[model samples]
Target: MNDQKFVDAVFFELFDENFCRYQDSLTKPTTGEQDSYGRARNALALLNSAQRLDVVEFLRVVIADTASVILGALDGVHFPDGLEGECVVSLDGVEIQGDLQDMFLSKAQNLGIYD
Candidate 1:
């Protein structure tokens, strides 16, 4: 799928499956062991986990296809072992919400991933 379609896909996924039901006190968790608050937090976390630049090509940021958005929600992130939790699109000034301004550089240098 095209890039715009990809981003929009992710947004729709968050909106349809989880966001709409987030206010409920008994909604199921996105991940295991998540309570009501955790479930709600997962919904935001899933959307926030998406890299803004990945789907920000041309003047598009969201796709017109609903299925595309649904599929895009599965795109999780994985930063390098030594880096921080936020994944960087690029090493220099080319980052986006995934760290458009280096949110973890200071700690990234001193961090260690045991996994």
Candidate 2:
């Protein structure tokens, strides 16, 4: 996929899936969680208009930078010693395996976000 498409796919994977999960967890949400959920819903709504391009770009940068930090921290460590060979990470119960950005992209692709 092209760079823009890849970015959009990753963003959609991150945002939409988490949004759904958070919505599901609001059955007995605290006040803070309820407020946060409201803000998240509003953010999702903003994506429908032209004014959200900058917001989307900003979120992309934040996601990339956050991924870099997390992946960088995991670089070159012995799995058995540091990660205990149980380092499996999942999104929505789907296994995701990779070092950094690949992890997120792989999940995105697995979810057919690129399609």
Candidate 3:
């Protein structure tokens, strides 16, 4: 993937965690939603720039192979057969291991990233 798309995926990954973390408090007609939204926006803006490479380094150290798998999936790159189920996604300290496509889609749906 290109650097821009890589940055975007990293930003979205962080945004998804923040959304899930604050979803309950982010109700309508309340400041909580605004707070969370602002945080998410700030996070994306900050991470979308030069700081993205640092974030990538952090991911490489913390998540290792999982990071590459996620980015690959987001970029529509298919993995070898039978390897899909080896993928593991970690969100906010919770880890889910399953088929790469299935896990990615389900996580994105839960984060309201897809219709």
lDDT string, candidate 3, 81-107, tens digits: 555533444555554333444444445
lDDT of 2 by residue, 1-115 (tens): 3333444555566567653454454323234433766665455554654544444444544555565455434443224335434345445565443444555555545654444
* Candidate with maximal TM-score: 2
Ten contiguous residues with the weakest lDDT in model 3: 24-33
Query: lDDT of all predictions, in order shown?
Result: 0.34, 0.48, 0.45
Q: The CA-based lDDT of model 1 is what?
A: 0.34
Clash count in backbone of candidate 3: 0
Off-target runs (Cα >4 Å) in candidate 3 are: 1-13, 17-98
In model 2, the runs with Cα more than 4 Å from the true position are: 1-34, 40-48, 76-115
- Looking at model 3, residue 89 earns an lDDT score of 48
Tens digit per residue, CA lDDT, model 1, 1-115: 2333333444445444443454342233355546656655554445533432222221122222232322222222333345444332322353233321122221222322111
Clashes of each: 2, 0, 0
Name the best candidate (by lDDT): 2
